[model samples]
Target: MLPADTESESYRFYKSLNEDILLKPNEFNEWDMQFENGDVVNVTGYESLQNAICIAIMTRFKELKNPLYADFGCRIHELIKANKSRMVEYKIELFITEVLTNMRRVKKINWIKVTDNPNNEFFKYLVEFSVTSIYDKIVEGEVNL
Candidate 1:
């Protein structure tokens, strides 16, 4: 049996892609994803995508053109203006852009796809998207609203 070498090319490749701290909701948080303890778990590229999707879906951006500007929970019912689906799609693109602006891993948003869910009454829409890649690796995420 051969002992693994951390200096090996394969090991280094994996380390570069995987050696990152995973962030989580800590015991105490006020806003802006605050954590006094700075708690983190396993490192994962997919987790970043998942979190970004969640944040985008959960919040309504004050400025759709700007990043990191949002308020919790969009009033979808009342805010439905002319062209409901288009409005939702636009908002999602902006929200995803906002979240991924600071994320170093994801290069660009490939696309933001919004679809109708006829069966689900509570969530009439489903959002699907991909933020391209992190170090040549792809990650996908989704939201239902």
Candidate 2:
């Protein structure tokens, strides 16, 4: 992996795309994307698209976009939007349940540890690691997916 200060053209591009989509009014279609069209608008709430962005990043890093992961990302966004601003104590359990419920619709999730204790640091680490991988994965794609 490159150092933090290392400048990656891919990173810059993803950062720009992330900024664009996050700020776009309504859902912007990929086919209609224009880089120099407008200044970005500020975004307020976290939406399902954000989860899609994260998943896109991860799949991009893998240099391969799996249909499953794409579906997983969309599912993430749906689950997230459905459950807004719950207490911190219940957040992990709710997130796990959401993951399991959605995964059951397709395939069983390979990794799950929150059933024992939702607040476990390991579970937190797993989620964070996956999300961060998405960022790196985006860089790997070197193109918007």
User: Which is the leading candidate under TM-score?
Assistant: 1
lDDT of 1 by residue, 52-144 (tens): 546544555453645545443343334445355666666655655666555555667776776765356533566677775566556676655
TM-score of each: 0.47, 0.21
When summed lDDT is taken over every stretch of 10 residues in candidate 1, the lowest stretch is: 26-35
User: What lDDT score belongs to each candidate, Candidate 1 first?
Assistant: 0.52, 0.31
Please give, for residues 40-126, the per-residue lDDT of candidate 2 as tens digits: 232211222243333442332224377655444222222333433334324544454454344322132333322322245322222
Q: Quickly count the clashes in candidate 2.
A: 4
Cα lDDT for residue 86, model 1? 61
